[model samples]
Target: MSAPKQDAWVGHLGPAGFDLRSDTMTTPTASMLAAIQSCSLLDDVFVEDPTTIELESHVAELAGKEAALLVLSGTMGNQLALRSLLTQPPYSVLCDHRAHIIKYEAGGFVHSFCLS
Candidate 1:
C-alpha cells in the first residue's frame, strides 16, 4: 500500500477539506486577505480596536446574544465559557468521550479549572 498523492485529494485542500490537522492548512479568500491587510492591528484587550468591536457586534447581533468575544481558537473560547459557568467550589465538567476540550487542549481544564 502507498500513501495517497496530493492530486488524489487536491479538491479536499483548503477550507473545502474535511481534514482537521490544522486550521492553518486552509487557504483564505482574496476578500478575506484584503480585509485582513486593511485591518487595524491593535491589542484588543488594552485598546479598543474598531474592526474587532465591529466584528464582535455583528456576530452578537447575528447570534441574538448580548455580546460576543473573539478568541484565538475554539478551544480557548470553550475553556473561557466553562470557567465562567463553573465558578463554584466543586468545579467540574461533563463532556463526551471524543470532546476536543479534553483531547486537544493539553489538559487545559485540569490546569485552568482544576477539573479531574
Candidate 2:
C-alpha cells in the first residue's frame, strides 16, 4: 500500500487523542486508511464481500466455532451476543455498570432481554 500523505489526517492526534474512555475515539492510522481504500465495495449482506467473509472465517476458526457473523457496529454485536445467550425469557446479564452497552446502547439489553 502507498504511504499516507504527510498532511493526511491519518496520524494526526485530534481532540480525542488522549481520551481513553471509549474505543470510538480511536484515530485511524495510515495502514488502516490504505486498507479501507483497497477494500471491496461488494455488499456484505449478500455475502459478496471477500474481506468481510475472510475476516469472519478467520475469527470463527480462532474461536473454534463453525461460523461467525460480522455485524455493522458494537451495538449490533452486543445485541446478537445477548440474543444468542439469552434464548429464553427472564434473562439476566451481569456486566459492569460503566460498560458501553449499559451507558450508550439506549437500554437495548434491558428492553430485549430483561423485559422479554
Candidate 3:
C-alpha cells in the first residue's frame, strides 16, 4: 500500500491521519494555526477573552439565539445540549448506534445529566 499522505500544513501525517473513527483526528490547516497564534490568552471562565467572546457572540447571532457558550470539547457541548433540552427526567436521546457521544463519551449523558 502507498504511504499515508503527509499533511502539507503540519508537515506530517499525525497518529490520527489514518484513523477515521472521529473528525477530531484531522490536522489543522495553516490558516487555523495562524488564527490560534493570534487568539487571546485570557481566561474564558471570567468572560475576559475577547476572541472567545467575539466568536460566541457571532455564533449566537448567526444561530438567532440571545447568547452562546464556548465549550472546550465536543463531549462538553453534547452534555450541555442534553442538560438544557432534557431538563425533566425520563429523558431518552435517539441516535445512531455508532454516534460518537454514545460510543466515546463514557455515558456522560446518563451520569452527568441523569438521563434514563
Candidate 4:
C-alpha cells in the first residue's frame, strides 16, 4: 500500500494563517505615524506652513514652473492644473479614456471645471 498522503486542506488563511483580502487587518508603521505628526497644521491656500511650502517648491521644481500649489489628490491636482491653464471656464479638458478623474471622480471635472 502507498504511504499515507496529506489531504487537500487549507493551512492558514481564514483557518490557516493570514488572509490579505480581509479588511479587519493592517497597522500603520511607526514611520507613517511620525510623518503624520510632523506635518504642520496650516492653511495651504495661503502657503503658510513650512511643510506645505517645501512640497510646493518641490512640485514647482519638478514641473519646471515658477510655483506650484498643493491639492488633496491626483484627481484634484489634475483638475486644478486644468483650471489654472484655462482662465475662463468651458474650456476643453483632454484626458485619456481610462484616466482616474475621467472614470472615478464622479463627473467632478465636467461639472466643476467646465461649468465654473
Task: List lDDT for all candidates, in order.
Answer: 0.76, 0.79, 0.80, 0.69
RMSD of 4: 11.4
Window of ten residues with lowest summed lDDT in model 1: 3-12
lDDT of 2: 0.79
Candidate 1's TM-score reads 0.72
Predicted candidate 2 versus true structure: per-residue lDDT over 3-114, tens digit per residue: 5333223233454334433456566678988999999999988899899999999999999999999877778888999999988766888899999888999999887765
List candidate 4 stretches off by more than 4 Å: 1-28, 87-90, 113-116
- For model 1, residues 26-103, the per-residue Cα lDDT tens digits are 566677789889999887997479888988999999999999998888888888998899888887678897888868
TM-score-wise, the better of 3 and 4 is 3
- Pairs in clash, predicted candidate 3: none
Q: After TM-score superposition, what is the CA distance of residue 76 in candidate 4 from its true location, in Å? A: 1.3
The residue pairs that clash in candidate 1, if any, are: none
Q: Relative to the unseen true structure, what is the Cα RMSD of model 3?
A: 6.0
Best by lDDT: 3
Best candidate (score: TM-score): 1
Model 1 whole-model lDDT (C-alpha atoms): 0.76
lDDT of 4 by residue, 35-55 (tens): 989888987667578888998
Worst 10 residues of 4 by lDDT: 6-15
The number of clashing residue pairs in each candidate reads 0, 0, 0, 4
**lDDT tens string, model 3, 1-116?**
77867774434475754543345656677788899898879988888999989999999999999999988777888888888898776788899999978999999888996545
